[model samples]
Target: MKTSAADTPPRKRVIVLIAAGLSVLLLAGIGVYGLIQGPRTGPPPDNSEADGPAATAAPEDGTQTPGRIVPVERSSDPETFARNVATAVFAWDTGAGFMPLDYTAVVMEVADPTGTEQAGLANDLAAYLPVREAWVDLRQYATTQHLEITDAFVPEAWATAQAQAQPGQITEGTTAITIEGVRYRAGVWNEKPVASEHEVAFTVFVICEPAYDTCHLLRLSELDNPLR
Candidate 1:
């Protein structure tokens, strides 16, 4: 994808609830991630289960390149990483020769690293691969995309998992865990419609190795409401 920066159009904006399709990103093993009204604070529950492994302040790769079409650097800060990821999820460039693999590669870069802990990145990738292929096949070209972080809050499930996780161990296998409250828009070029616009509310689920210290994207899902 070698789209010219000048050819990029101003993002067209609209507002609506996220579609059900994105919610299906989760695998059968884990149910859809959801959010509660307000933040919760308390001691770890007796039966609380955690996801993957505990968070670690691992050194981030200091790689940078000009003219890079996609972002692949894993960040030390999960919130910062999430906001950047929200943009990537919504935006694409057909002029730049963007492909589905390019999009998913960036996604994997921000996903929890797979190793001894079994963060389930493989499962998330498996679930998203088909959707990515379908998206590239359907939306042949996209002119512009945009994302806004209207608000952000820890989902109740993730919060609980964090509380329950041991100092060096992150809870794994829970169906809940995500950062909710995002708005997105994109301008797509398709043969049938020729051109189209999409706007929706969505969330990004992530795994934090040590509670909130370090995290990575797990999956993206649509939300009925902004959940602000």
Candidate 2:
């Protein structure tokens, strides 16, 4: 039977509390991604000719060009599933006629089946994706972003957290995978193509196997902060 948050066991509650605290820290501006919050006044005025033609406008039908970002095929393999979730979390286009919530929905589609973690997972995504205001600001530059994963592993901290859990406190197949990657962003600035890249790391908590035939996302670590 599904249990309410108030009915969650003590150890499980501790884990959730820890994740919540991290979310608070992220919102407080600690380690916030600068690209999203940086100068929003649009590209500089002087580089018009050097930058190339202005980016093509979004389709009038309100559809993404190239293609919409979507998650990889579902997998029973924990590592594969974690990578899929990581990709879905980081891939987005501000000019794609989709809001941050649209991208958030992609990940939430595979969230905890019991619904226990969906709310927390939504909070987790908020830390990774720009808010609606920031999204609009980025759209002006026609910005799009994706991640190139460099490494993924079960971090030692996850093992430690597991060790502290009381029997049955954590779901049967739950695990945490830390993903390290380079975030790449591209857009038109002054009518010219411009791009930037930054290294990022985060932990994805998931459950797979006996818990379900395919893995499901549970929560995310603070951006640039991964279990190690």
Candidate 3:
């Protein structure tokens, strides 16, 4: 007898339904695997193995050195000392450059090694104002008169001095000095004044400590009377 739609067996229909479900599950598994291990598109062409982890680099020494804690030295350099003092008083004192220190700090740094008379210099620096219309001596200028100290900060002073030290088309000169078994011939910034504060001029010196460095200018033997 021929089979009709209503006469089809329930067992055969159940087998067909199970086969369709298994086929769908197989397709989903393959898609999931491809998503995870599939070839990457836009990464660097050199990295052919993009499916793996990134590689790291080694240092030039072939090994990494762990960081160590260290300390700083606070001593001074005679050459840098001279330059720093001069910079503090003359050009600009601030930053890695000359630092415009306060009366105490300036006296401490610019003390006369030839004499213990910085106390006197400090007292003298307290005697004048910065707004005067007269010429100030190296020693007196070394000693700041006005303790009002409106602007004795190092960076600020450096900016002020640099602003005052009109940057001249740099000229060239040299000077030599002997200190602690070392002879040095320093290049002086004696170039023509490219600035407004040519009220005074002096040679530069550098002071170095075991751990630090400072700049200063020589104490000029003569003085300029700007008001005259």
Per-candidate Cα lDDT values, in order, are 0.39, 0.67, 0.24
Which rank order by TM-score, best down to worst?
A: 2, 1, 3
Candidate 2: deviation at residue 44, Å?
Answer: 22
Question: What is the C-alpha lDDT profile of model 2 across 60-158, one tens digit per residue?
Answer: 455555456576557888889999888888898777678888888888888876777677677778777776665676777777788999999998766
Q: On a 0 to 100 scale, what is the lDDT of residue 78 in model 1?
A: 57
Task: Sum up the clashes in candidate 2.
Answer: 1
Better of 2 and 3 by lDDT: 2
TM-scores for all candidates: the values are 0.46, 0.73, 0.23
For model 1, residues 72-152, the per-residue Cα lDDT tens digits are 445546566666666665555433455545765666665544331223443433332324433443333333344555655
Error of 1 at 32 (Å): 3.5
Q: What is the C-alpha RMSD of each candidate to the true structure, in Å?
A: 18.5, 7.6, 38.5
- Which sections of candidate 1 miss by over 4 Å? 1-67, 115-142, 160-169, 172-199, 208-214, 221-228
Q: After superposition, how far is residue 95 of candidate 3 from its true place, in Å?
A: 18
The residue pairs that clash in candidate 2, if any, are 51-192
Q: What is the overall TM-score of model 3 with all chains considered together?
A: 0.23
For model 3, the superposed segments whose C-alpha errors exceed 4 Å read 1-77, 91-105, 109-115, 123-195, 202-222, 225-228
